[model samples]
Target: MGIVVNQSIKNTFITFVGFAIGAMNTLFMYTHFLGEDYYGLTAFLLSSANIMMPLMAFGIQNTLVRFYAEHQTEEEKSRFLNLMLVLPLLLVVPIFIGLALFYNETAELLSQENPIIFDYVWMIPVIGLFMGYFEIFYAWVKVHLKSVFGNFVKEVLLRIFISIFLLAVHLNWLTSIQFVYSLVFIYFAMMLVMAFVAFKVRKPEFHLQFPKDKKEVLLYSAFIIFSSGIAVLLLDIDKFMIGQYIPIKEAAYYSVAIFIALTISVPMRAMHQITHPITTDLMARKKHEELNQLYKKTAITLQVVGGFIMLGILTNIHQVYALLPEKYSGGISVVFLISFSKFFDLMLGNNNSIIFNSKYYRTVLLLGLCLVVVTVGLNMVFIPSFGIEGAAIATLISIGLYSIAKLMFVVFKMKLFPFTRKTIISLLLIALTFVVFYFWNFPFHPIMNILLKSVLLAVWYWFLNYRLAISEDINAVVKKGLKFNTPR
Candidate 1:
């Protein structure tokens, strides 16, 4: 918990900084500098690429973490590491060739509903290729328990570059198309920087040999691809399908609301960076008792943290939307639905890592595959009828259903659950906080109003949690921060 607390706090701070920058870009720069149409196209391109990444990487990032902890000798570790490095190429190279051969057709297909996508369609696979490798190298260092640096780069660096690119467009230095191309270069740069850092963390010990459990490794990677692919799909597929079914500008509108809601998940993302490897190690040693404890702790901690953010957003959302441009204001409902969906996801804690590292991972994979179909089907029905709001509804339903299934499976199969008495108490506290502060407002600027309300809300929320000691880990950190002695 020491390392988890230390790194997760730092990572959470860094991730918020990134999201802050991204919010500025999404809310102000993209909307103000670039027109809504191009903004949507940019969002569409990035979402499509993200959906492609897990497939291109072939689940090597997860496979690396799971197997790295199990291997003992340096020689054996090197072979396993080398195998992880090369496995993605088996999928990447063919995909690259296929994209090249069918580039025109692919663009044509994507542009049928929104022809604005044709010019930039080529960047999807190219960016996905780089993004996929970035995760692989990022995971390489993560196994060594060196996650902060990678987390900084993963969360911060690329967004900083995007901010610059957006400014370049405002300065009349880069055309909209050039700005789109610059994203490809930016992703590639991140891949190179990550590769260099990974090597510095542990120099390449490439071997042309296979691990003793080569068959098992390949099988895990093969099946884990579906699991990882399904995860990314659930996250990104909504935006992609929006581009297919609706006008491209609607995608931009949805992206803005989705970004606002996604800020709630920053803590979960930060915790997962460190918790994933630890969870893998725990399962490798079959520490079921400790695993159950970690599962509950993570779930409750994330719920408390995530719940605070969600409450802030839900309470302040009207004022927040009042500040946005008229074109993007219709996504108010999108924000509410998506924010709750993310909060639900956060409550699952490290459920994905737990299942992926366990022997029952294959069963989870099958469930994920089925959910993928359900997600697409729901999006197909909802996006056309309800528009962006419908897409958000579809996402909430699919993700909520999938999360429930995973939670039940973990509890039934492993006898582990991520809830306790404090879980119910925390839920009541969140509701009470929202109801109390939500109607309270200041006769000031929207920005100032949000700031005042959020500060008050956070102070009130944490004050009660601390007094009640909802989470020991959080209570310990809070007490230390305040220079107060811990209670026995």
Candidate 2:
């Protein structure tokens, strides 16, 4: 727990910095520099690539984390690493060949609704390939218990480079079209850098043979592709389909709102980088009691942190949207719906890490496939009727239900539950804060208003949690920060 808290704090800081830069790029620069059409196109292209990444990476990123600790000897671990590295090519090569073979058809299908997508369609696979390998190498380093550097590269470096590219476009040093193509090069460059960093961390002694549990390894990887693929699809499909059913620019509107909502998940994302390997190790050791405790601690801490973020966003949503262009203001509802959905997700804590690494992952995969079908079907029915808001509604429904199912499974099958009395208390505090602050604001600029309200909310919320002892982990951190010599 000490290591988890320490690394999570570092990761949270890094993610916050990265998201701040990204917010600048997404809200102001992308909206101002590139028109909605091109901005939406950028969102569409990246969402398409992300949708394909899990498949191209062949779930090996997850497979490595789950199995890496099982091998006792350095020789066995090296052989396992070699196998993990190469397995993705078996799937990626065939997909690339197919893409090349049917490039025109693929472009045509994507551009059927918006011909603007035609020119950039081919970049999807190119970017997806690089994105996939980036995850693979990032996970490789994670299994070595070194995730902070990789998190910096993924969360910070890429966004910094993208900001530079956007600035290049603004300066007319390159046209938007050239900037688009430059993204492909940027992602591939990051992939190569991560690969180098990972190898340097623990130089793999490459081997061709597999461990004795070869069948188990292969089966787990195969099933994980479906499970992890479903998860990515759940996150990105709404954006992808928004482009297909409506004007591509609607995706831009949705993207802005989604980015605002996704801020709530940053803590979970930060914590998960370190907690995932720990969850896998605990699960393998059958430390069910310890795992359950960790699960509850993470859930409450994330909810406490994520819930406050949601309050901040929801309370200042009107001001936040006022800072955006008129065309993006309609996405205010999109922000609320998706913010709640993300908060729900954050409350699940390391539930995903547990499920993905458990023996019941295959069962979860089956359930997830069913939900994916429901998500797509709902999006299809809803988008034509409700537009961008409809997509948000569909996502809310699907994700809400899917999270429930996962929570129930973890409880019934594993006898683990993340919610505690403090969970309810935290929810009440978030609600009370939102009600108190939603109608209150200063006669100030939008940015300053947001800053002031966020600070007030943070001080109040953290004080209540600390005073009430809603989470021992959070309170302990507070005590340490305040230099209190308290008994454990």
Candidate 3:
């Protein structure tokens, strides 16, 4: 509890900072600076890269985190890192080649509405490979509990560069094509900086000391890759379908709306980064009690924290849309819909890390892939008719299915559930929080109204936690964190 709480504080700070920069770029800069077409183009290219990530990564980043502990010596860990580092090129280079082989037909078929997108399809593999290796390197640092620096690079520095690049576009310093390319370049810079920090934190020697359990590494890597593909497909397939079915402009609109709504999940994402490896270690030691406690506390804490953010978005969604132009306002529902999807995800706590790190990982991955197909298939069915709203519907349905499936696996297979009395009470309290704030519409300056309402919602969220005495584990964690921080 002490470690989790301490790490949570640092992660919360990082998430909030990252979010501030992200909100600046999305709400203020992207809309005010870049025109809709270019905004759509910029968003489309990035989504393409992210969607390509899991497939191109071939599971190496996740594999590294799952298996890094198997190697005890510096020489062995260093060699494993180098091996994971070079593995992506094998997966991604062939994907680039295959895509290039069918480029003409592929370009001809898809380029009708957005011809510019075809030109940048080749960058997916490059970006995907970088993201995969970056995570592998970041995982190296994560096990050392040196997450703050990597969090800055991943969350803060990248957004800072993006804000500057968009500002340049706003000032006519760079054209749209250059701006799109600049986004990719900024990510590459982020990855390089994180990799460098990982090296300095604990330099892994550049030797080949392959683990004796080569078979375990291979099995884990293969399963982790499939699991990652399912996750990537679940998250980004809607963007791909939106591009194919609707106008590019609609894809851009969905991008902005999803980005805004996705703000709620940022804290959970930050939470998972610190919790995943710890859960793996606990499970390895057969510490089911600790694992279960972590699971319950994580879900409860995320619900409290994530619930507060969702309160801001849901209660103030009207105001959020008010910040954007009218065309982008359709994503208001996307905000609600996707925010719920993420909330449901937050409710699952560390279900994913547990499953991936467990002995039954293969069975879990295969089952999850079935859900992934349904997600994509539903997106295919709905996206053409409703456009961005259709994409939202598909996303909501798919994320719901994925969440349920993950829970079922945990319950039936692992005999674990992340629920507690606090979890349910928090849900009801959040419902009340929304009711209280939603009707209190403040028509002040957009920024001021949002700030005041957000602060109030945040306070209300914690107040409810205190009132309900949610999760003794959380209370203990908080008590310890507060007491330890008290002056000696």
lDDT of each: 0.89, 0.89, 0.78
TM-score preference between candidates 1 and 3, better one:
1
Q: Which prediction has the highest lDDT against the true structure?
A: 2
Model 2 whole-model lDDT (C-alpha atoms): 0.89
TM-scores of the candidates are 0.89, 0.90, 0.87
TM match of model 1 to true structure: 0.89
Give the TM-score comparing model 3 with the true structure, all chains together. 0.87
Candidate 3 runs further than 4 Å off: 1-12, 66-81, 140-147, 198-219, 285-293, 455-465, 471-488
Q: How many clashes in each structure?
A: 0, 0, 0
Top TM-score model: 2
Which tens-of-lDDT digit does each residue in 1-488 have in candidate 2? 66656766787788889999999999888887777888888899999999999888888898898899999999999888888888888888998899889988989999999998988888998899899899999999888777788889988899999989988889999888888889899999899999999999999786768778777888888887887789889999999999899999999999999999989988888888678868988999999999999999999989998888898889999898888899999899999999988899899899999987878877888999999999999999999899999999999999999999999999999899999998988889888988999999999999999999999988998888888899899888877877866555
Ranked candidates, highest TM-score first = 2, 1, 3
Q: Of the pair 1 and 3, which is ahead by lDDT? A: 1
* Model 1 regions more than 4 Å off: 1-12, 67-86, 143-145, 201-216, 274-290, 484-488
- Rank ordering of all candidates by lDDT, starting from the highest: 2, 1, 3
Better of 1 and 2 by TM-score: 2
